[model samples]
Target chain A: MEKENIRYSELERLCKEFRKTILKIITEAGSGHPGGSLSVVEILTTLYYLHLNHNPKNPFDDKRDRVVLSKGHSCPALYVILAELGYFDKQELHNLRKVNSILQGHPARVYNGGDEVKFVPGIEVSTGSLGYGLSVAVGMALGFKMDNKQNLVFAICSDGEHQEGSIWEAIMFAGFKQLDNLIEIVDYNKLQQESRIDDSVSLEPLKEKYISFNWQVYEVDGHKISELDTALADAKKYKGKPKVIIAHTVKGKGVSFMENNVDWHGKAPSKELLEQALKELEGK
Target chain B: MVTVLEYKPSREGLGEALLEIADQYPQLVAIGADTANSTSLGKFAKKYPERFVNVGIAEQNAVGIAVGLSLVGKLPVVSTYAMFLAGRCWEEIRQSVCYNYSNVKLVGTHAGLTVGPDGASHQILEDIALMRVLPNMSVIVPSDANEAKVAVKKSLEKVGAVYIRLSREKLPVFTSPEEDFVIGKAKLLREGSDCGIISCGVMVYESLVAAEILEKQGINCRVINMHTVKPIDTEAIINTAKKCKCIVTCEEHQVYGGLGSAVAEVVIKNYPVPQRFVGIKDKFGESGPAEGLMLKYGLKAQHIVETVKEVIKYK
Candidate 1:
């Protein structure tokens, strides 16, 4: 793998393209999450383009770093990234949420048509229910450590999922085990499905909570690639304790009307709104 | 004739079996939810500290972590109480282990009402039902200590999600060391002509005792250890139904979705027969002596004998 230097201009352009691709698929699917998907674009773009050590052709490479979309409802963003990386055909993006499509509502290993053999390999694990991906990531990191491998396990979880008790269980276990190779990025858009996270269930002093659990915590501007790059780089160098990046972002980023709107959490854009979103992203 | 060997908890057998096979399968790992001594995983933890992981009373995390470990070419055996493992971590097991077809072995100890003085809160009577419903899951209820050891060994070699239901109380070893243990295969304990008693777990011992009482009364009842609950031995069930003309299913679990329900499903679909279930009714248990709870919950040999007699009348 070639070491690519961080370029903010190129990442900014890629982030716009990712948001456009997400809008295209979610609108085509008729019912998909646009808010969280748009919010996670720059974070995912920075990881895939700059930080993650992976190969588009050989996804099953043992030494490759892994990224688990803990907030799996935002799979339109992940599906677009995987398609761009040649894990599957880019045209399959239109078939999102359709029966027999590799891209299901949640991220899952794709099966071939006739024999039902699992062929699409980029997906690490199937995650839809909240609060499961972090523990799975901890397991992977522990396995890599046991084998003396340098591979890192990164997981992106939602702000609302923090309310789940199991998420705290994972946090406590990762801290006690001292899994320095694991990194958790919270897409803290402040809004859950029903309402704002603070109104529903407050996670105030969230960084303090992670610190109490012995995690090295960092808060970053989620939309800015440069800040995310620096935070991720710093997290990689830290030893002993696991690291968490609370990426502060807007729910529906890059779009005018949907920004911070809880209604867009799971609803797809209307035909007119889709056209507007595409125009805004294209103008960027 | 039944051979009564020294009694041992099925959980101890599981621990010993893992120790026996640890050298062969170097990639095998043991995970516990702070119940190492209770689940008999302390032996493995003592011998191989590096391979053992104590997730600290978190059953859901234990299951999810096992799935992750299995993905990286390591076989993980996760241990916890039956109620917590099958109830609390059910969705995690369904999504991470069963859905992904991960090679994760889930050992649920303290299964059924035999958990004794700890009472209904600790007892788990619905684990069999919870595990058998999953698509890629294999459910096993070992009949005794010897069978539990073999079941653990077999689960390690098989490459998919498996749930092994073990007992906390010491059970008499009815199975011989020479007996072959295979997943999804039923072991026939006694041969008779009037009726057949199909049972699993500790209930198998009571079924054997019931067969003896029935034999003295000129009612010859065959005894079958139907240990593998999922992918049940449908052919054995059908054949027994044909030979006996009636069936009596027994288990130390709820009659609704446990061994009895599984047997009825096979019998109704393949070969319909007049049947009766000898297990707990739809009611919770309370704190009591193990033997008293077994008798009160209708899980004893006398209950199996009565059920056999009633079902044989239909023949």
Candidate 2:
């Protein structure tokens, strides 16, 4: 697979900047998921900057890597990266979740003109409802395999979303068909909207579960850009089976008060918290 | 009366149409959720093995996969029992297929009481209502095998999302293969002026029979095959309301949100004509033979004839 030659130091710096932008946009929008957005920043940054074979100039290229944000509430992270890569104007990020903004609360492909919003370029498919993105990624991987194309599909999922029965259904199909080009990065933050994942519906033995379905499973620290980069690279080389990286991450990773906090999962930072969070990110 | 050629399940029409249009649409793919033979996609699976996918008893995953296949320039056709496809995985259809405006064809087979022995749990009478409510989704209920085949072919020619409802049992093919199957266009089968009968799916044949029975009693009835339920033939409905004394809407679906409600939404707004609904009442379908189910549910031609007469009195 073709990859961009960005250094580890550069990816680290980009993750910090992406975190600040994600916080700013959510605070500006008045309501958004900050925890998951913060948790998956390193995972998305590593893929967009170093691992993915994608181009902002030709967003619809036949061979470009397709990334589906299955945990759709965390689209602020994706929106920031797509904009920084010049997929769209960065100014559009300020209008996140605003009426008539292309950046919806959830990742959307084509926006109906009813709300004065249109399609968002670089967004693979519309996904807000959980457990849908993986299946879609499976479909895309299947399509690429049928066409004999080498393009890979990267699906970023959340731990809570695995509770949906449809996710297992998709996993079974992808496993049975041996979709080698599909790689899923589960942001294992261990928390959902209202409660902890283990307290809610436990996804214990997660690694063994994927292995049972014939997936090449790996566990890594999601916040470490180096670990994510290495796992994604190694997974791409393995063939004859789909790959999944259970990226253990902290909800609201970068900020001191927000890290591992469930309250910040879907709540936007207040003006005071925004200033404090930005200062914490800059100091780091 | 129109010439009835042959009796065939509408699912066979859709399946055969998939085989026919495969050459024309090289990017076309079929996805099924363990209903390959039941939905009649088995023939396509056998011939075009590479392009066919059996996702196995998972309707939500089937729809989600179709959305992905469609995103990557493949015209994906997904089929399963209507009860599962429309009723079970409705959110997947809403977000993945309809919300994204994915060029995916959703074929809901064994719709309504026609599924017969499957009982209420298997028979889906609310698919039209569920599909029609979604934005960027076109709902199509074919009247017979020939029309169902045409619907599948035409759906591929067009872009965006479409829901094609089919039946399990064989019905008389009243329409010709040569007839053009335009989306949202109603086919006027029998022309009359006394009352206009609007029907879709298998009920179209029953409506034709009812029109014939009424014609003998000096009550001229116009029978229309309303194949496309959403993006409904508003113009034809207005014209029917204008020409006829009253209108009767017939379908194998529930009377609440299927063809009857679609026609009423048009008539009450566009022409404000007197209308009667001839469909399943607010109730679940019980297990029975197809013919007995039709009669027990009051879905026969006689019921339609009676509804037309009752509505004509109001007119």
lDDT of 1 by residue, B1-315 (tens): 567888888888889899999999999999999999999999899999999999998999999899888888788999999999998899999988887778899999998898999998988888899999998899999988889999999988888899999999977887886689999999988988799999999999999998998899999987889999988999889989999999999988888998899999989998899999988888888888788999888998998888888887788
Q: For each candidate, what's the DockQ?
A: 0.76, 0.84
lDDT of each: 0.90, 0.91
Best by DockQ: 2
**lDDT of the structure predicted as candidate 2:** 0.91
Model 2, residue pairs in steric clash: none
Docking quality of model 2: it rates as high
- Each candidate's interface RMSD, rounded to one decimal? 1.0, 0.7
The CAPRI quality class of candidate 1 comes to medium
Compose the digit string of candidate 2's lDDT tens values, residues A1-284. Answer: 22333577778888999999999999999999999999999999888887899989999888799999999999999999999999999999998998877888998897664656466789988889888999999999998888888899999999999999999999999999999999999999999988899998899999999999999998999988778888999999999999999999999999999998889999988999999999999999
Worst 10 residues of 1 chain B by lDDT: B170-179
